[model samples]
Target: MTYDTVAETDPAVARALEGERERQNGTLSMIASENHVSEAVMEAQSSELTNNYAEGYPGSRYYGGCRYADEVEQLAIDRAKELWGADHVNVQPHSGSQANMGVYLAVLDPGDKILSLDLTHGGHLSHGHPANFAGQVYDVEQYEVDPETGYLDYEGLRETAEEFDPDVVVSGYSAYPREVDFERIQAAADAVDAYHLADIAHITGLVAAGVHESPVGVADFVTGSTHKTIRAGRGGIIMTSDEYADAIDKAVFPGTQGGPAMHNVAGKAVGFGEALQPEFTEYAEQTVANAKALGERLRSHGLELVSGGTDNHLVLVDLRSSHPDTTGKDVEEALEEAGIVLNANTVPGETRSAFNPSGIRAGTPALTARGFGENACREVADLIVDVIDDPDDEAVVAAVGERVTELTDEYTLYE
Candidate 1:
């Protein structure tokens, strides 16, 4: 992981690189969508394959000198198929958003209707936020989690689908804390003859490890980010039945993106191989356990969790009920000052701006990757509450910062 070669050529960039390394080593990364890939994955991502342009799939390329590229991509595809039990897997979309785009291009024409969860209620932008292309190009309607229960309202979703009759019904979420019932959603899609697209971007690892219910068999198409809980390289994946494989592949290549990032595919291969091991199941389980402990501890402090708790790796805290005056950004900045890093998030029935919303989202994927367990997570939760209670108190922030340093030192990441 040394930058000696880069330092010899570009001292300034090398300094920033080294500084980022030190920063990560010093802080607790509680962002749910983030994780530390193993050195093996990193090395594969940094391989010479970065220079390749294998514009097409394995065994069929648009250019010469793609022998190595084909091998690497095929390995990644095979590993992903095994990991998710997918009939077909495409690890070529540059990002999870692009994977959704590819799926959109494969079936729906512009202006086709889409039904998805509301962003303020845990949906991703690609699912059809007004600012995103999906929203602009498609006719979109939204579903919501029950305000009282803070959980997906399946019956309500069915009602919406029956009325809206969307071309696609999108499942999965960004900040939700509970497990999804994909079958219920699929039934809703079926009632309207719409495609069911389950975007498992945040819980890829949990689904792969059987720690969470998978949407692979229930949904018509499944999409995910490679680097979230899965701890793979940074990329997106699409899984579908053999019926749609050719359409998906063509849609990804000529429809949305061109020339896949072969180095990232290599990284995906290495990371997927790692996930296939028994240790990954333990890691995924620990990730959930740590999140449960973190949520329980936060709830005990009188904080209002979105769904009251978690069945996965993240918990969404709606600050309005408890800390009525505090914005999510206030806690986010204060926590960063104290060396704990997560994100300010939007909650259901949001009354504030998206930038400085009513909630904070915290997760255990990165912390679990750093070897933290429930006890450590509970301790971190206490530190978080301390900062939330008195964000403007410099002395309190300094004290919590000191403890964060100790915890990071004890956990020791990327060494």
Candidate 2:
């Protein structure tokens, strides 16, 4: 992270860094799981915390000079616990995938069965993709979204859980548009005497900001990212019920990772602090407003939304019905060309490949935070629909791209 002496001779890196800043200023970042951290958080992340290893938690570190490190780590933990109302918080786990991995490691043996959401039907790769460790190390059973409604099949989940009798029942997703029925999932898990792990990585900010239901009180274990909707640094976080405290901490510390990233933890502390502020609540609310507005506008333009529209920060744009033969890859690349960035995602019953999916996933949290209101979100979605439905139209493309540049100018990133 050091560029202190690079400016003296390494002009190339400096130019590249400025180019990155320019990209942020111009491009519309619609990636659901991405956000730009604040200057305070960035400053803390690049601070002296990086200079120290501080292996081990708090005062029990192997390093001698870890008093301040302990302070920083504990500050993150306390603030996270307060924000999420959890019994225990581990600000380790590197990424959301690893956080869930540690949760599985804590309670389940290798080859133990876990009932989770299916990969293409809104589940995360970490939940149980065949290529991921979750699938290789554990017996992964899966549930799916309803084919007709494009929403959760609670009865299907219950039936699947009853049949599988898994050691753990996992709930959460990267593409689901509706609010999760955590209570129903919990009841099903309880019926089968299974533990429940809710991966709230995508909705952490919503939950923390009180826009969505908190999974902390209901799930036995909850895993999330400090980034994404949480809008913190790029790191995974693990929280547990008091009964599983020791096991969860051990799983995260020795079983999964050795040393914690103190710098990231410091950034997490700043993020948690920001979340505690009243304005962060306003930011979180505006994120949802922008999302709902964008979804409505897109659907009005004849675009099909999986589950109709989103109740949260992200929406998955189903393209097959809207623009025939329009792959998610084309939509993504085309949008990027116009300086609007969003990821290609899989829609329910996606017959296409995962590499180039059938849908585009977009969110408004970052752009909204950048000062795009509901009106701006609606306009952006209208332009997006235009670009996707008619990419070959040069004049339309140019006009939309110009609006994007003008919009960002009024709500600048670094300004």
Candidate 3:
């Protein structure tokens, strides 16, 4: 898409926009929570609905001239319900973090206890980090994965739930590589008479396509990001039974957020429509397969993966065992220079600071979106290893960059 209209108004911003588009076309995006949406979704997101304020649900907006807005929002809601099978769905919150905040506002009183995973152990800031509003308002305790196995310790979680007697137990994860047993977590929440909020923010599409176990019926509330595995535009979604529908709607509208982003809701409608197609199932399945291929190749090259391998679309590599002196930041920077982009994430039992952590996290959603298969993913893994093995070697970096250029060209994005 040309940015000529934007350039007419602001050349500087237009240039940056074009540069970002070029960068996405050039580099490999392996960030676990990122994806490339279809052009239709982008067009919907850039629609003129951005100027409208639809302050309420369909058929009950507080403003006039909301007929199209109502139609778009209702379509988004219907598609989300069909995708996730929830009795009630809220597609309002601006982001996944806002979705979590809406849930907190819906049920809990100030100072109520929350039990969630530790941030360094694959949890998100919205769950209960000190910097987030949830942490400031709630009494929070954290659980951890097993240090040795790098898997969630369900038995230990049960014990913690019993002892902490939290009001809400938060499941789901940001950087976790394994499939979560939402039923198991719900069982613990049930035993303690606490609510279970499964934040499937990262695996929404995988669950929708049945590649990953769903938390919809199992958990009290299910929240997700539409832009991750779902390949939708940027937005957050919350699903619950009809019993909590009104509470959630009120919390999202008059509680945590103002008017919804109608344009993004339109984008969601388009993206969700696309996901319901038969090919999306193939895409989801291929995403997981490619991740397994990438992880297997990385492990074969002597990198230590958290949990030994992946059950989903992401793999977290703990570098302490394989390269004690090389930090994730070092590898992250070198890999970016070589045109393969991913994030430096903290592993379970972390010994380094959060800024420059001990592990790297990579995923296959965007690559798979660009038609990369298992062999391509393995080759990408090899390139990653080459750079990590010799970050300072100019020749190695140059060679890897050349290969990345070929792959990006071979499986062209935004063409």
Candidate 4:
């Protein structure tokens, strides 16, 4: 992790890198869509494969000097297949969004209809948000979680699919904190004769470790980011049946992306190999258990949690009910000052702008990676509640920041 080589050429960038390392070591990262990858994975991502230009699939590359690139790419594909139990896996997409674009290009023509969850209700922008290309290219409609219950309204989703008659129905979410029933979503898609694209970007590790239900066989196309719960290199992956293998490969290669980042593919191979170990299952289980404990403790302090609690690694807290005057951004900044890092996220039935939303999203993936268990998560929750109660109180923030430093030191990382 030393930056001596970089320092020789660019001392400023090296200083920033060292500062980042220190920041991570000092802070608690509760961001749901993030995790700590192993140093082995990091090494692989910084390998010589970064210089390769393998334009096509293994055994049929469009460039020469790709022997090692071919080996690394095939290993990533094989390990991803083993992890997810897919008939075909594409490790080429630059990101989860690009993977979705690849799927769209494979099946849908311009102006084809898409039915997905509403953004404020825990959906991703790639799932047909107006700001993303998917919304502009396709005719899109959306479903929402039951505002009262804070859960997906399956019947409503089915009804929407029937009425919209979309070419594709997207399942899975970014901020939703429950086990997604891929079968139910698939049934909705089936009812409308629409393809089901399940984007499991946030919970890839949970699904791979069997802690959460997988969408590999249920959904027609599955996409995920490697760097989230999976803790691989920073990249995207697409999984599907062999029926659409050729189309998907072509769409990913010539349609959405060109040459793959083979270095990241190497990282995927290493991280996926690590996930296949028995300890990873325990890690995934602990992540969920920690989240539950965190949410329960937060609720005990009278903070309102969306859905009242969580079944996964993340919990969304609606500040409007308990802390009526507190915006998520206010709490977010206060928590950061206290050395706790998460995000201000929009909640279902949001009454404010996305930038300064009413909810704060927190998760346990990074904390779990740092060896945090239920007891530690509860303590973190207590600290968060303390900050939420008096965000502008300098003394309170300073006290919480000291406790955070102690916790971070107790559960050390990257050492």
Candidate 5:
């Protein structure tokens, strides 16, 4: 991981890269959407394939120097097909947001309707936020979780789908903690003649490892990020039945993106190969176990957990009930100061502004990647509660930061 060449060429950029490496090594990373990839994945991402311009699928590229590009992409696609049991997979999308766009372009007209969950209610912006292209180009309506229970109101969603009669129904979430029943969503979609898209961006590896219920066969289309629970390189993926294979491939290449990021495709191949190993299953189960342990310990300290607890790798904490005066951003900043990094998030019934929301979201994927188990996660939870209780207390922040340093040293990463 040394950057001596970069240091010789551009000291400023090299310093920033080194600083980021140091930050990741020194602190805890609890962001729900983030994970620590192995150095093998990193090397694949930094491979020489970055120069390739493979404008099309395997054996049919528009460019001549695409032999290796086709090989890497085909390997990634084959491995992903094995991992998720999809009939067809496209590994060229630059990000999860673009994967959603590819699906939208493949199926819907310019003004077709989209029915999805509200952004503040755990949905991604790509689902239909007003600022995103999906919102501007498509007619959008939203559903919500049950305010009391903090879980998806599937019955309500069905009712909404029947009334709205959307062209597409987007399921899956960014901040939610409960398991999604893709069958129920598919039933609602079937009732209304709408296509169902399950975006498993946060739980791709969990689903692949059989820790979470998969939506591959149930949902009409599935999309995911390669970097979240999967611990692959940073990229997006789209999976669909063979019936829509041609449509999706065209929509991804000339429709939404240009030449694929072949280097990232190489990384996906390596990471997917790693996921196929037996130890990855243990890693996936440990991720969820650590999350549950963290959530239970936080709840014991009087923090209100969304959906009561987690069924996956993340837990959403609604701070309004436990600490009315504290905002999620306050906790986020204090935790970062204590060397424990996570994010301020929007809760289901959000009363605060989006910038400084009413909840915090934490996950154990990155911690588990660093070899943390349930006991270590529980101790981290205790440290988090200490900071949340007295954010302004410099002594408490310093103590937690010290403990975090010790933990990070014990479970070293990226060495």
Candidate 6:
């Protein structure tokens, strides 16, 4: 037979569920790649679809009894296409890294040249980090941010592309804090006849909500995560123009992955539906506002932010400017002790090592979605700055942590 609700019939499982809920309630999740999905999305993600083993795309599945799976997967595909205006959409890749890998398999050989942004200068590891498969499989060249401005060095990008003549030029970032110049990048890619792949994993929701520029039609390929800013279930999507549809589809299916996660695909459809609403555009705009507010507050307290501040949802604080004696690990630990969470990131030209880099990466999406605004972010900034500047002051840290709980407790996210 079948079991009832795990929480209702199993005492030990119910206790574990309660414990997990408490942990989420007590901690602050400021990780750039994470967010709390809506209840609707969560419901779909936890549905019975998780038990299915539909081994292929909708109509051509390798298994029978895939009627519901077909409907759900196709809905996700159609909604993604409508949302981004893409000629094709594949919601099968399990993560952002997988999406990028599928693109590599689609267009380039193992020894083919690929150019991307450097990790320290705001690029993702999947783009070309030496430790990743991309670097191992291809001829990887990197472009750095402007030494003076700390923004992208488009001129340098052009020069590098012209000289290296990479088959693909990847555009996207993990630590970047400003708007990307997609048009300029398109021109640079055109100059060298390189295919432009825009991995808008972090900014996908913003682009979909119209707060950021859409790369769907402009770039040769666009890849994104379904969770991060989209607040959907965890998965990845690959989209492209009609010309590359067959290549992209083949790359994702037999090339890089097998069956899609039907549970997550259902959740993605709900998220795309939410994104189509006008409210999502407003939410995207508020994320930017909250980030800028937090950035200004941090700067006012003698902390120097990368690029002087942010133009988007992220803030990269170069802690060396304020705590020349402290490292990013020290601050991340201190903040975690004070009920705040964020990642330590590498800053451009940082003299510090990557393990304990000079900067901390924070974002506004999760907090803003929890109903946090500019004033609340200022308070958060003060608490973060206090913890960093006075890590040894246990009393001060405790007080800041208490204040953070008080501020965040007022604004509830999903249960």
Indicate the TM-score of model 2.
0.97
**How high a TM-score does candidate 6 get?**
0.96
Stretches of candidate 6 exceeding 4 Å from the true structure: 1-17
Local distance difference test, each candidate: 0.96, 0.89, 0.95, 0.95, 0.96, 0.88
lDDT by residue (tens digit), candidate 5, 224-281: 9999999998999999999999999999999999999999999999999999999999
How well is each residue in 229-263 modelled by candidate 6, as lDDT tens digits?
88877899999988998898889998988778889
User: Candidate 6, residue 89: CA error in Å?
Assistant: 0.8
* Per-residue alpha-carbon lDDT of candidate 4 for residues 1-415, written as tens digits (9 for 90 to 100): 8999999999999999999999999999999998989999999999999999999999999999999988888888999999999999999898999999999999999999999999999999999999999999999999999989998999999998888899999998999998899999999999989999999999999999999999999999999999989899889999999999999999999899889999999998999999999999999999999999999999999998989899999999999989999999999999999999999999999999999999999999999999999999999999999999999999999999999999888888886
lDDT of 1 by residue, 172-198 (tens): 999999999999999999999999999
Clashing pairs in 3: none
lDDT of 2 at 399: 82
TM-scores, all candidates, are 0.99, 0.97, 0.99, 0.99, 0.99, 0.96
CA lDDT, candidate 5, residue 412:
99
Residues 1-415, model 3: lDDT tens digits: 7899999999999999999998999999999999999999999999999999999889998999999999999999999999999999999989999999999999999999999999999999999998988899999999999998999999999999999999999999999999999999999999999999999999999999999999998899999999999999799999999999999999999998889999999999999999999999999999999999999999999999999999999999999988999999999999999999999999998999999999999999999999999999999999999999998898999999999999999999985
Give me the overall lDDT of model 4.
0.95
The C-alpha stretches of model 5 lying farther than 4 A from their native spots are none
Question: In candidate 6, which residue pairs get closer than 3 Å at backbone N, Cα or C atoms, i.e. clash?
Answer: none
Any residue pairs clashing in model 5, and if so which?
none
Q: Which clashing pairs does model 2 show?
A: none
Candidate 3 positional error at 26, Å: 0.4
Q: Which regions of candidate 1 are displaced past 4 Å?
A: none
Model 5: number of backbone collisions? 0
